[model samples]
Target: MPLSEHEQRMLDQIEQALYAEDPKFANTVRQTNPAVHYKRWIIKASIGFVLGVSLLMAGVIFKQPAISAVGFIIMLSCTLWGLSGWRRVVGGAEGTAAPVEGKQPRAERRGMMNRFEERWRRRQEGDH
Candidate 1:
């Protein structure tokens, strides 16, 4: 239901008053939006991933095994972090059903592998 004009005006007035009373608090509350937070995470992770790539390249050029290893670790961790944030952002935007835990049977999970194995077995028998 839409709010009445009078109610909307009143709500706006209250918001203005609140902002006037403490703009800092209001700004903090506005910045606390989940979407914004997730976006920041994604951006930071992307930067870290780039940095890792540079480190890995530099390590290979300098023949420093330890630096290269550290760079690889940074790249892996950053990719995971960024992907997680991206999933949350996309999921929230789409408002679709989330994946249920422990709902599928083990056979169902292995269905694709089973099909591949069956095909291989048939091919092997036919070769004789």
Candidate 2:
């Protein structure tokens, strides 16, 4: 359901509180970029296809039809691969889901030594 005006105001207030208290922390928490950020897989495949064509020319020069056939296969495979990834690249960031949102935000807990030191400090200061 869409938030009512009152609910929207409350959410905005909470966000403001978070930003005011620790803008740096809040910004850090929001950085959930995908590890597999698409960097033109299709472009890479095009380059590979070009290289395959070059290889085919080399094979022809060397008088090896077998090598030429292999190069042709390589070119075909690369062209197909490039075409397959074309749609994904065009879809952009919205197509890919943020990794952090779907799963729990895993916190690295304080180790035993850190806890012990904290306890020791509190005791010396005469506080719990």
Tell me, by lDDT, which candidate is best.
Answer: 1
CA shift of 51, model 2, Å: 1.3
lDDT of 2 by residue, 1-128 (tens): 24569977998999899999999988977673332333466778889899889889989999999888888998999998886676565443434555445442224446455667677788878898
Instruction: Report every candidate's CA lDDT.
Output: 0.81, 0.73
Best TM-score among the predictions, by candidate number: 1
Screening candidate 1 with a backbone cut-off below 3 angstroms (N, C-alpha, C), the clashing residue pairs are: none
Structural similarity to truth (TM-score) of each candidate: 0.52, 0.42
Could you tell me the lDDT of residue 108 within candidate 2?
A: 42
Q: How many residue pairs clash in each candidate?
A: 0, 0
When summed lDDT is taken over every stretch of 10 residues in candidate 1, the lowest stretch is: 103-112
Runs of candidate 2 with Cα error greater than 4 angstroms are 2-39, 91-128
Model 1 regions more than 4 Å off: 1-23, 92-128
